[model samples]
Target: MDAPISWAEARTAMHEAGRQGARPAVAVPLSETDGTTLAAPLTSRTDVPAFPASAVDGWAVRGPQPWIPEGRVLAGERPPALTRPGTCMEIATGAMVPEGTEAIVRLECAHHEHGRITGVARARRDWREAGEEVSAGEELLPAGSPVTPAVIGLAASSGHDTLHVHRPPSAAVLVFGDELKTAGLPGLGRIRDSLGPSVPSWLRRLGALPVEGPAHPVADTLEDHLAALTSALKTADIVCTTGGTMHGPADHLHPALRELGAEYLVDTVAVRPGSPMLAARLPGGKFVCGLPGNPQAALTALMTLTEPLIAGLTRRPLPSLRTVPVAEETIGRGDFTHLAAARLDTHGRAHTLGHAASSMLRGVAAGDGFVVVSPGGVVDAGMHVPFLPLPLYAGEAPVAVRQEGVPAVPLPDQAHAHSTAPR
Candidate 1:
């Protein structure tokens, strides 16, 4: 068997593959730009607050206090200029401030009687100046920035009807294994298929647009694998296949890749539980990520390989790891790097969770992300370790962390003591 590459090397290799195969940018309406990556700098087409406007409901006064009343200026209307030195006009909030206005006297402070106005003007200017928030043609956000709700709002405010952004790469999941069942309880030498139903959700959170429909299942034969992969690659920029990564009799992933003339970018990674994960690029430039059959291991592969690949595909920089203190002593996997499922407390400490076996999903379901334990290293309590946060699923709330006064749980054993070869 070939030696496995380090986890970091595997991630880097897949990232480069994505960058080489990045999708072209397209102009999309501003209403549909959320979750896309910017292809060009988002520049303001017009000044924010295009005209000088009132910051409060007050009197637009010229030449100071005790001014004569003129007229009322409501929001959305262009008011006439305050030509006379002692004249004032009642102005509502957000109404354009007329030219020649010196200051604003708040409504409460002004007394109007006998068709005249008298009041003390506020110390601070009560009107917003044109282009005060943002000047026309200024870059609001740079290329590669993720289009968020705030970004969309800012784009609209700056007069952008549409934005040029990189279209999200589409992915397809191919589940392999003759012994896997799509539904019902696992029994009679057949287990329920987990990856088929879950992998698409993970891909979506990673910013990849998963092809519509449930994951396609492939039989454990070289011909079947080739057929399934060929079909998936036709529609998806990336194809994720679960199981069949090993060189066993039933494992056809490698043979299919060979027959398809795919180049191996990461044959395997040196990470516990997910060590057999592999990434390859087909001749057509689409990617293939081979995940282990184990549920937790498959998720780990998604983070280690698929996440960075999507980042590159969208022209985004590799996601940076956050450092947090360990809440308890944590063991490592000797030579292999360990990605321990963990929940982060409000205090910013990582509490490694239990039930983290390769096939178990309980730990990950309750955790915020994974805490990285470097090869051959043990992290003591209070020591800082790198954290890889899980992307938030659509409409999913953040995992609640332990609050003050909550008793800390003991650190559990590492997910697995030995590396799990691909099934």
Candidate 2:
């Protein structure tokens, strides 16, 4: 058997693969462009709101003056005559303030009378200044910037109709198995095709458009395996196949990959439960990642190797992992690093979850993240552990849930909470 590659080496290879050809382009309406990467920088032709707008439901007025209601000047309408001193104009939220207005005072701060407004109190500093939110000719959305809900709203506010964004990389997946059954279907000896649904959904989360190919039978013959791989790469920026990539009785992916002149980068990894992972780049420049058949192993490869590939294509920096303290002792085998699924409790303490077998997916799903045990000996409790975050759907950062009386070191970096997921 060939020697396996280390995690750092695999990551380096995968990241290098991300620097390939130009990504596809797409013109998406501003409303649907959230979470997409900008293909070019968007410059504001006009200031956001185009004029001074009221941030609160109040009266627009000049500074150091009492409000004297003369006539209403709602948003989108011209300011009433300022011929009289102490005159005020009523402005609604999101409404544009008329000319000569220097600031906005909340309605409650002024006294209302019959056809007159006065008795302004406690001056407000919260006026929406013109060109403050977005200036004319300013870079509205820079190229390579990922659009968030706030970004989309800001772009729309700046008068953008269509956004130029990098079209997400498309993927085709091939699952090799005769003993695998479709999800939610009855199975006797055959196992459920866990990779089929999980990999697609994961790819989508990673900002790639996933195409699921037909499942091929697990074969000992290299010819059968090569055909399956060839089909997957036909329309994919990257092809990911499950099983047969490692060194074993049915490891046909290695020989087939060699036949295609694929530049094999990492054939195996030093990580537990996912050591059989393989990565290669074809002559045409498309990348390939082969994951072990075990469900968790495939997930490990996806999170580790595949994410960098998508980041490279999309021109996004791969998110950094959060570092937290392990709440219990862990003994390492020294030959390989252990990526044990773990629960990060409310108190920020990371506890290793049992049933870390590569074949187990249920435990992985239940885990908040994973505790990485480097080659050596036991990882004692209360020791800090580095962990890769799972794809959490919530918009906010997850609060740590810690065991009672156990002190946990807070993860230093919380910026990893940001993601490319569509809001």
Candidate 3:
């Protein structure tokens, strides 16, 4: 028997394949740029504020207390430059402060009587100076950065009406099994299909566009598998096939790829429950991911291969697996990386979610992410172990890095909102 590829090796192969086939960048309106990645560095077209602006709702004064009121400047209107010292202008937040303005006095900090404003403030130049936030021709965001909501706001403030971003990758899901049903309860040696709905959510979470349509069902026969594979590759940048990854008599993924002259990037990965996961590069440069029939195994396959693939296709960085300390002992396959569903409690510790068998989704539904236990090593409490948030489950970064990793909410049509029959 051949040894399965290391998890890192499998991911690298998929990422390289995806990079080779990454769709070219296109200019999209700012509204549609979210969830994509910048194909090129973002430069400000003009100064961020374009002029000195009030940082708060107050009065812009020069030379401090008891200044004569000149006029009022509401947001969106410009005030003429100050003629001399001891002059003041009422200003609202975001309103442009007149040139030669020294400081902004908060409404509560200023005492006005007989058209004169008096204030006791120590700070000077309290308003934002021109080019303070960003100067024209300055780089705002680097290439490969995710186009998050905050990024959108920055681009707009930097005078960008649209963004150059990677075109969203397209996908197709092929579910291979003769005994799979799409709806209603399963019985009589048949199970309901689960990949039809869940995998699309994962795809969207990684920045892929919606699947072309419902998944194509494949029977155990080689002919059905060949036909489905051929058609799915034509329009999809990547094709996800659930089931038929092993060498069982009915497994036809290998034979189908062979017939199509496809090259196997990953025959298997050394991960528990999903060791049979596979990836291949099609003759035309598209990708095919073979996921085990078991739901958890398929999800593991997704995390190992599909996530990096989408990241590369979107021209984004494939970051290191984030890890957190585990609070409880968990164990799994000693020969391969052990993956278990887990929750992070308020104290910042990972706790296992029980019932995490390859065939069960209950633990996944109850968990926030996957806990990683290294091969052959017993994970002890307080051990720093790898963890991956489920599709659309990762929340916002700390306040300090919020702009870089803003929170993302799952779409209403995403998997969390939709249910697929179990298979």
Among all candidates shown, the one with the greatest lDDT:
1
* lDDT by residue for model 3 (1-423), tens: 267977767767777778878878999999998778899999999987798887888888888568998899998996887778899988999999888777788888999999799986546656777899899999988898878799999999899999999977788888888889988899999888888778877777666775665444688999988888888887888899999988899899888989999888888888887889988888778889899999999998998899888877877666455556787777757568777888888976789987888999888888877876666657666766656666643222212122244333221112211122111
- The lDDT ranking, best first, is 1, 3, 2
Per-residue lDDT of 181-298 in model 2, one digit per residue for the tens?
7755746787777887778777777667788677544455788878877877888888888877666776778888889999876788887879889888898888788988998999
Q: Which pairs clash in the backbone of model 3?
A: 334-376
Order by TM-score, highest first: 1, 3, 2
RMSD of 2: 6.7
TM-score of every prediction relative to native: 0.89, 0.82, 0.86
**Candidate 1 lDDT score at position 236:** 93
Cα RMSD (angstroms) for every candidate in the order listed: 6.3, 6.7, 7.6
**By summed lDDT, which 10 consecutive residues of candidate 1 come out lowest?**
395-404
Would you give me the overall lDDT of model 2?
A: 0.71
lDDT of each: 0.83, 0.71, 0.78
TM-score of 1: 0.89
* Segments in model 3 whose C-alpha atoms lie over 4 Å from true places: 63-66, 108-126, 393-423
Which of the two candidates, 1 or 3, achieves a greater lDDT against the reference?
A: 1
Single out the weakest 10-residue window by summed lDDT for candidate 3: 414-423
